[model samples]
Target: MRGVVYFIIVMLVASSLGCISEKIEKPDKKRIHGPKTKKIEEKRQVDSTRKRLGVVSGKWEQLNGMDGGDMHFIYSTRSGVLFVSHGFGGVWRSKNGGESWEIIKQEDFTDVYFYDMEEIGEVLYAGSNKGLWYSLDEGESWTKLKTGFPEIDDGTYHLVSLAKYKDELFFTAVLDKKYRNGRPGDGRLFVLKRDKTILELEAPANKEITVSAKYPYLFISSPYSGLFFSTDGKRWRKILDKKTTNVFVDGKYNLYVGTIGDWWYIGRKIGNTWKWEQVKIPGRKNTNSIFYFLVPDPINENRLWFGCGGVSRFYSFSARGFGNSFFGVGCWNGELKDWKIHSNYATSIAFYGDEKVKTSCGEATKYALVTVGRQAVQKTMDGGLNWSNSYEGVFGDTINAINPIKSGILSGTIVVTAVSGTEIAFNNGEEWMKGIDLRLGKEVGGGKLPGYPWCAVSPERRIEGKYDLLISTGYPSPFRGDGVFGIDTSCLVRGGRNCVKKLIGGPHYEMVISEGKLYAGNMDNGIDVLDLETMEVSKIDFGSGVPLIRKFDGKLFFETYEGKYLGDGWRWSGKKGKIYFYDGRVTKTIYEEYAINFSVNNREFIALTPESLVYKPDFLSEEEIRVKLPNKKYTDMAIAWEKGIIFLSTDGEGVFYTTIDELKSGGVRLKEFNNGLLTLKIRNLVYEDGYLFAGTRGYSVWRVKPSQV
Candidate 1:
């Protein structure tokens, strides 16, 4: 009867093994697919090289637009140059007649705008949101000219126009106190003589003014207070006060005033008597109005240029055609011929809308994959599709490994075995707080640690939570020693005010927590597991392999370079390539080779290799293997057993993932997202909630959600 029962159990076990093996089938060979590729090899090289330097390269191409800002043009007469300032301090200068442009400078200043420029003899004057800037050597160098300005509102003053009349210069300064919420004072116009002295002029109370200097007289226009003429720095006379906004003067002293309302007047010098006459142009009458105009021709006096609304016109003071229109800037030899618009102007008009085009994702939400060459970390949020350069500022260009604290937050530790710097970010990949020198004591190596740092983060150590950081460092090899530091999440809530306690230190590689026990892997000192409650440490010898601890099914599992130990006395030996289970007195070995790592999911043992996952039910005899992963180059893997997910990072290819069931089914069912990488060369993977975080050698850190892919 006992033998009969044993035979029934054996039959059931055989049947179960057959069923599991039938379910696990080898996946069909298929071409691996990643992110969209264009210049794959070139991008890979650029991404890798930049990661080594610890400085992000290339312009933030994604921040072209999508904000409420306008682009204004700046021209240099001395250099015949034209540039564009994105009103916000980003300046791009074009040298080749608007053919191409290069960024000159991008300063971070709020509510700043560049207004006008004027070259007087050898000095170049620029009017902007701040005030006036004077360059002595023809725009080569500039100095702030804010001597005689009002100190109460100097930086806030907006200079609208700068006009040079002979040796003297006159400028219109608008004090936008309204924008400042009725702070104090009104707008004024200050005339600066060639001697750098202010020539005070009597102006209206609080009107926005525009000015133009024409030798013996200066023309000023207000949006609502009409036109005024000033001479000798003090006296002013009303010329055509009718809500005018812009004004221009020719070499012959003929004044042209444009009104915000529907009016463009031409004041001619007839026998010393300035007679104002209204000239009619061809454009629709009473619908469009002139904004401003400029006469670039130095020779022709009667040749008038009119800039109305969004169009430009040229009139000879004689031809009677509907508003004579001509674009571009050049001279005519007084042939009384119809003027033609320049081709460049036509092209500009054709692509005018392109100027406002911006990336749909603003500066905050975009993701970038970054990598450092060595001793640093890299990250890419777009799945190795497009990558940014390495982020330095943290480890002073010496980052060893990265651990994700939480979503959009990462921590990097240096290699030299000392706490040097840390970086934190909250707004996706837009900006980061760099150079957070925690100043956590001296170097590990007596030979000067290259910003020696190695960092680990708890599950809640992101922007949403506080504290939760661990770091350790020590000299490499023969001089190795134990030094570990830990930071509690609650203490970080108040901005790192709490002290960091020392744990154990050595050439630490990885730190993990399993079953409420903290474990630190060291190269020279084996593995140290600390009891969070008792504060006691236990050293585990991994023999020739490094000791690693991981949690599965609420139980801790130990791994070494050779094989794995599943708590109790069960040990899987890779020497004979077999599995064994012992009840302390006897040991058994079963034939099963090429298994790399194992985890327990739902009380079942799951094994992993470079390209597959194996599931063993109860004993090795009843086992099933599935080939899910591709043969692509990979560097590391992290499994979240409870979530049934596996994160695989590649060398220069970025990070990817798959499910446990998909892997056991032997059919590679993986979804690769756009992470912007050719080779991520990741070093580690961490999972918290449903987000997967990747750590790379030189790359900072990266994170993404399962559903986001």
Candidate 2:
């Protein structure tokens, strides 16, 4: 069955048993089965096919893992200079095969956010939100390309893709006429010849255009426009009229185009004629799958790798249930009767080399390095048979919460709960170590993993004179029940999963330890008090749960949520929220507003709403003041009381800082303080030792000195 085309139809059930033929007949239209029976039968077929193909499994490890953040594009030049671009994190270069990475910071390209990057000869070209950029010294520095595009800063043209045919470099620039208005625009192709001359041509489609080239053949795949081909780099002709998402030209010149529809068509040029086959992954029927990424095998030209997700080429936002039937990295060699499904939800990939290395599983070879969508950068040394997470020296996941150990032997240490698991930083904010086992990757049915650690609190008390940590786990929609778990800080430094104990069961948005008691503010249930000595539990209910909790000057204050749930960490739905002062006896609603989270100091209480921050001074005084902020949704806030500084994190924008004295004098100037950060989607913030730790949505934890800002 190698190198054969098989048109799979409904009656191709026998193929699941590792048998295949040239063609399959259609099923009888009159035949029908019950929903339950049909589902079971389909599962059986999929299981059989996957088992026959020896479903590749391994523990994934991160490579070039320097808190690289969420990757937008990853490409490696022929000379082995790997470039990975993070939209706001800037572009990073790894010369030693991802062993270490450094951000490419240049004077002229500080704010340039690259969407695509390609190398022609020794010059690297990048397409950004502003304009096109080129680097001559392997990304040591960069210079903007002077293409005479209209209003480069005003978003007139956004270069999205780049390709090369012979000696000429071709690029696709989307003419974004709306600019700051945030709307889609048309795209066109431009040719950059060796003589520094530019030639413009009409693109096949207006938006969502992609270009790929391999020597004599250059192809463009545009969603809703069709696949186009060109040999001389100027004139083009349509090859397939399908809603294509991407085009991949293998080393052998075999063309593959992925579509958004039911069938994926593989286009192969035989002689002067082109042949197309509607192919499917053996056994499974992917009626809605988006093959937005494709890469040829570095060692084998026949094998084609792919990445699947629900994102559409036409739209920027992810559409649910569109192409989510399969989400991961997979490969198809055309010669095989089945596809080789690899890692999970990888949007981009880059090969290191074709060298075969010795592995634990017999004599296998190392493969590629892939960015696993805000999780980690993974590498497969033994062809995906076994894997391990390579997060050493890399901070690539989202940091959900940060806890600074103020007491005990691990004092001054910063412990954080990220998207992957728990990490502890003992040396101020310089390095991090994953020593605690949080059981992060435990599956919770429906093909979903449990929620990550949302909050952590380190108490002064110790067990066996060793440091301990109490972490609460939860997300917007957690697959498992949220609860607080305690773990010994000394275990699992060298990869062990023991020394963990569940202390309490419930979703806790905020937690604080006062004296010998731990007060946790739950979103579903009301406040729960746990005595550190006896581990006894007590509940305080005032008709609703609290979204925010604090311990100030021997007093417990919490915010009650009489609003809708916003599907986040104890998020206060914009309806109503009241901060109450709890004195261990009675509760008083001191301040009421539409606040979600807040930070407090000795003088005033700074509350964060959906739109801006609310300042209440004079010990919960009736004066409710609204501070001005940029028109961005704020998520979390923190305060350095001694320094009189306040920090705010946004959902889209980066971190903003202001002084508390400025708020009192009605001159609060909230300024953005993101200098070395890579991501703008800040999730939470905390302050300690003049360093402000920002937990971003994708880039993990980035710390900045307030004095520098």
CA lDDT of each prediction against the hidden true structure: 0.42, 0.58
Candidate 1, superposed: residue stretches over 4 Å from native? 1-70, 83-89, 106-112, 148-155, 177-186, 204-206, 288-290, 294-303, 310-709
lDDT by residue (tens digit), candidate 1, 1-709: 0000000000111100000111111211231111232321101111222222211111111111011112333454555554334332333444443334444322222223356777777777777766677767544445777646564136555776778878877877776443545433345677777678776677753467777887778777775567777666467777775756556676678776665535466777676446876643434253433344433233334333333333321110112112332232212233212332211111011011111111212111122111111211222232222332222222111123434332111222111111224434333333433323243433433332322345453422222233245565533222333355664434443455644556665555455554345566554445676665566888765443333333333333344444342221111123323333322123333215444445444445655555555554433234454454556655455565655666566554556656655554444444453244212344444444444445433223445545421
lDDT value for model 1? 0.42
Candidate 1: worst-modelled 10 consecutive residues by lDDT: 1-10
Tens digit of lDDT per residue, candidate 2, span 19-87? 111111232223211012111110111222221221111111111212534455567778877776654
lDDT of 1 at 22: 11
TM-score of 1: 0.37
Query: Any idea how many clashes model 2 has?
Result: 18
